[model samples]
Target: MAKALPEFAPLSLKELRSLWKKYRGNEDIERLVLEVQFSRGVINEVDDYFKIIHRTWRQENLGELIAIEKLRLVLVKQHLRQTVLAEIKPAPKGTKPSEPPEPEPALVD
Candidate 1:
């Protein structure tokens, strides 16, 4: 019988962002990347937060770059919507998620 696969917890925002950035290149497309993540439901946040950032706090900034960066950050954070989520627990206790499965031996004649 095959060994049961171990489970893995979802990556945290900080971890996810770091991972995604490590894999993804070109900072220019940050907005687009964030938008995709937001739509994926990977980010689940309430509208009130967005209203506060985009509507209230956002008014404080008017510079082009700051405005753009802030917009993207707010969007990403809002979508992430994780206020008090549990930290992704370490790999199921002793299980190693990185280990590869053994290949089946060739059938004998």
Candidate 2:
């Protein structure tokens, strides 16, 4: 019998953006995000999942639980990107609001 594939649910765009804001400065979180985004299959294996979290924390010299939380945020962002893209609507022609673009982070420093 073929193994049943696990269902994967991506996070909402809002949630992903929030997580990015919260953890953008952490190198461990950055690494974890890359891993989760590129990993094959649904991430349903607990041991493998935790191992990634553990490795990231140890390599980055972060506290254990905090590292796990950061890794979770990465996963959330990956999921969000996948699921949220479909829901985003293009701005209507001429009717779109003309808000100023977000300022570059470097300009704020």
Candidate 3:
């Protein structure tokens, strides 16, 4: 871990998107990394509650990490597929969700 992100529950989509856009250098591996972190965090937090996992705290292969990485590709693929298939609803009447930000007035020549 180069730098750790703050511990966040029900992770914020806005923060994740910001991280994904700026911090995630490799778009190809973005989802894979997120899925792994999410999966591993869940397992660790659960074990933390039980207090019976990773006694030595070694960085060797753990079952959860292995399983998450193994399934990551498929999960990412599914996520992408679902997003692509999602419906696009226009902003409600009188609402401005779809509107672009108004441009600044042109400077005088």
For all candidates in order, the CA lDDT equals 0.45, 0.48, 0.42
After best superposition, candidate 3 residue 66: deviation in angstroms? 24
| 1-109: candidate 3 lDDT, tens digit per residue | 5997674344334444555666557866577547744653454344333322233323454435554444555544434432333221222345332343232222111
Better of 1 and 2 by lDDT: 2
Report the Cα lDDT for residue 41, model 1.
41
Question: In candidate 3, how many Å is residue 17 off?
Answer: 16
Q: What is candidate 3's CA lDDT for residue 81?
A: 32
Residue 11, candidate 3: C-alpha displacement in angstroms: 22
Q: Tens-digit lDDT track for model 1 on 1-109?
A: 9998685443454665664566566565555546544543432333323444555445776434576456667655543444334242222334322342232221111
Q: Pull out the clashing pairs in model 1.
A: 43-79
Count of backbone collisions in candidate 3: 0
RMSD, each candidate, Å?
A: 19.4, 18.3, 18.9
Model 2's alpha-carbon lDDT is: 0.48
- How many collisions per candidate? 1, 2, 0
TM-score of 2: 0.27
* Tens digit per residue, CA lDDT, model 2, 42-72: 4323324555657766899875586576766
